[model samples]
Target: MKPISWCSAVIKVERRAHAVHTLRFPAHLPTSSESRLPSVTSDNEIVQNIIAQAFSAIINLKHLFLLGQNSQPASIKLSTLASCTFSLCSFAGQVSGDLGIQEQLDFLLKHPTIEYWVPTEPFLRSVNSFPTNILPNLRQTVLVRPSLMKALGGRPIESLMILFIDITHSRAVEYTHGSLGPDWSTIDIISNLSRAAPNLKILTLGSLIKDDSVITAENQQSLVDAVARFCHLKILVLNTYMCALQKHTDEDPDPENPLEHSVAWEGRSPAQARQVATQFMTACPSLRRLSFPDTGPSPTNSLTYILSGTKAKLDGFYIIDNSGWWLR
Candidate 1:
């Protein structure tokens, strides 16, 4: 069965599709393993119309996604869906591509019930195309680009996750001043959030790093003061350090003290990470749980560093179980 004909078969179920709560449009078809995010594809005008017709027939959509691919410019039609979404709560517009989102701004502008938006990173936010009124009710977001905070300055946003993934960390920098790749070094995320979403509670900042995530004893004080920017930040998760997935030491166990817990997981220690977490709690007393999640996509357990009362500081600290992210 071809895609267009397949869509026709799906539309026949319009009577039953009223219960369908989510819809997605993927422009590039994905195979079985691309199940991370399923969406509508194909830019053919007929396909676009068919998808819109399918969406229009469904009456109970809560989440709608329109994804764009880097291979071509984005060309998803949205004008017809205005009457389709009486219950639409979340909408992801033009995720993953940089260009061709100018056409979708109309749909976002007219809809105030869309509480969440996940735009393509770096470029979309850098261009400032999303007028401030486009996302009036936006409360939570997965932000790969924080420059958008300027336009989103004073919303009632409650949560934000600044997730940065750098697989090949060997690129040179030139000040072409574009979003080809995001440089978090120069951007002060906390300052941006303090200005944009002052009421934010849960914030997750995940980055991929090559070095150990340990800070020295001398500079720990300064790091603590820097994190006191937000008032209601309860859960703060910083995941950048990667370590071995085992707790076995290489050399002899210090011969003198056999039961000492000085051994390292892989080659890095979570002592500094914990100390810094403590400092964050000290500076910002509202923080109840601080997590250092694993560098993952793992099948086992991940990591956490919440404020615990027991003597299990190193219980889940140094044990690298390659699993879940910090409360994401």
Candidate 2:
């Protein structure tokens, strides 16, 4: 028999009145403590195997957070995770089927403990497969790509308490594809999230709307509806372009097209602007803080309508766009 040193990482999992802790480490026997250095472990396979070993031991734990998994599927092997009391869990790259997505979901149904989840782009595609009952405790989520939205599609997400979506990372070059980025469709995503995570309190959307031509009126309306569904939203942040008011006079590819006007301004119309303001005001009646960039063709009108509608309800508001332009 050979002696091997192990780095023990302990995790705590708690249920109603019970608590369980699991200590996990890598499978391969380490020669010495020096072998655990950042340079010694170069392959991700070693890291994930370590996770598997750690999670395999505990029968029932509470609040699981897989902050670091190198390359193996972490979502499927939830026999151990399901038994634990997980209020917050995060997966780095992808959660494969082998991880027992359904079993984990069933466990969540019987014992709903997860409150916050952050799964990367690769895991988003299969996220919808989780049990619906687990949604009750899911309060916050961070979406990374379009696949994530698809995974959550048709699921009741209204039960959430807070959500943060980032679509600016999309690599799509076409405006059509770009506008349909993860954050764009997030309006509908939030709608579903609202149903699943009903206590949703905070929402944030950030993208480079100035460079993309995909954000239009129809998509805007859908997003507005999602916001309208948030009965408990207190903080809302929306980031878009306000460069519509600035276009080169010499640049005239077409002058008589109405679609050009809408396209020119990132899909801004008098009616849509008014509707956005109205919907936001009506959706979050208890709103305390609102922040958004003022850009595009009708920035002034958009700001006016949003402020006017939320004036009675808003506790505080901050305008972060067009700061330098206004100074000149």
Candidate 3:
């Protein structure tokens, strides 16, 4: 009998703690110790078979992590895995192109039990649009870049509970003087999530920049309005230099100089933060926690004001002295 090749042997499944299970499938099988590549068709077939076998064997698996260098298997059903993490280059590099990737992604997202999904790949430029009804049962998602937002195309996921978006890469386009491509802004992201995931309970935003020159009272109001849509939010974390501010134009410039507008010129003023806290607390009656990394001195004051004025009771709030703590 012929032995299974390295490509086939690489298919492995390991059970981890808390009922979580991981399945690792190699994208390509090595023919020799030096250098080699396996037949795309053969490798894909083996991967599909292995995944099916693993799924059948691991009935109680909760968390599934897929790790591959450059590619992923095509259209493998995973309706049972509660959480899935994909760390692949593009969908399936050589085997599945743009169209194939989209089709495969659509199939994978159809899983009914998937609650948390983290696709570590940046959005593929070839794929222009995403399916409308993707991940109907998804509850939490961690978007690493803005391209992923474009890939999702603002698809409404009514079941979403928590969302963490990091847009550190797009800062050049959003803050610096540059052509703002299809990149999304904090406001855009919040608005899209609000409309799509109305039941969102926790939202954490990173790398939010507020250029006083560009952001005015009206712009800040827009942000406030967007946040009001999260009627069920309980925990809010803003890892930003500034909260959306009230728009102030040159003609009717802010009474105080922009430099002296607040303790932290680039950050939200106590008054402004208090206003936002009040509005958010009013809109989201369940809000119990608030956190801001860049809040200047008296971070708790604004939130405290809200607690005193409104009926909202905050379990706790934090004004992170160091920015690195929240990112960790």
* Clash count per candidate: 7, 44, 7
Task: Give candidate 1 misplaced runs (Cα > 4 Å).
Answer: 1-6, 29-43, 66-75, 79-83, 93-102, 122-126, 165-187, 208-219, 240-273, 293-303, 309-328
Question: What is candidate 3's local distance difference test score?
Answer: 0.44
What TM-score does candidate 2 reach? Answer: 0.46
Which of the numbered candidates is closest to the native, going by highest TM-score?
1
Task: Give the per-residue lDDT digits (tens) of candidate 2, residues 1-328.
Answer: 1211121232222231233332222223332254554543443445445444445444444444332233333333445344333333322123444544555456446545554455544334345444445545454556543334344444434222122232224232222232234344445445665564455566655443334422464465566566677677776665543332232343432233333344434533433333344456666675555544446522432233324434422222244442111011
Give the runs in model 2 whose Cα sits over 4 Å from its true position.
Answer: 1-61, 69-111, 145-199, 208-229, 242-284, 294-328
Write down the lDDT of every candidate, Cα atoms only.
Answer: 0.53, 0.42, 0.44
Off by over 4 Å in 3: 1-56, 67-103, 106-110, 123-126, 132-134, 144-184, 208-218, 243-276, 295-328
Residues 1-328, candidate 1: write the lDDT tens digits: 5544545766888665677777566645443244333433323455557766777777777787765444544444455464565556686644424334664576667667777776554344345635777778888777555556666776678877765431112131222222323343322455556667788898876542323233334544544554577788887665533233222334432233322244433444344334445556777777777665443432133345555542113224444321222112
The order by descending TM-score is 1, 3, 2
* Model 3: residue 130 alpha-carbon error in angstroms: 3.7
In angstroms, the error of model 2 at 289 is: 1.2
TM-score of 3: 0.50
Top lDDT hit: 1
> Candidate 2: worst 10 consecutive residues by lDDT?
1-10
lDDT of 3 by residue, 141-245 (tens): 654443344455444333221222222222222332112233546667678766556676777664434433222445766766777778787777655434343
Give per-residue lDDT, candidate 2, residue 93: 26
Residue 309 in model 2: lDDT:
35
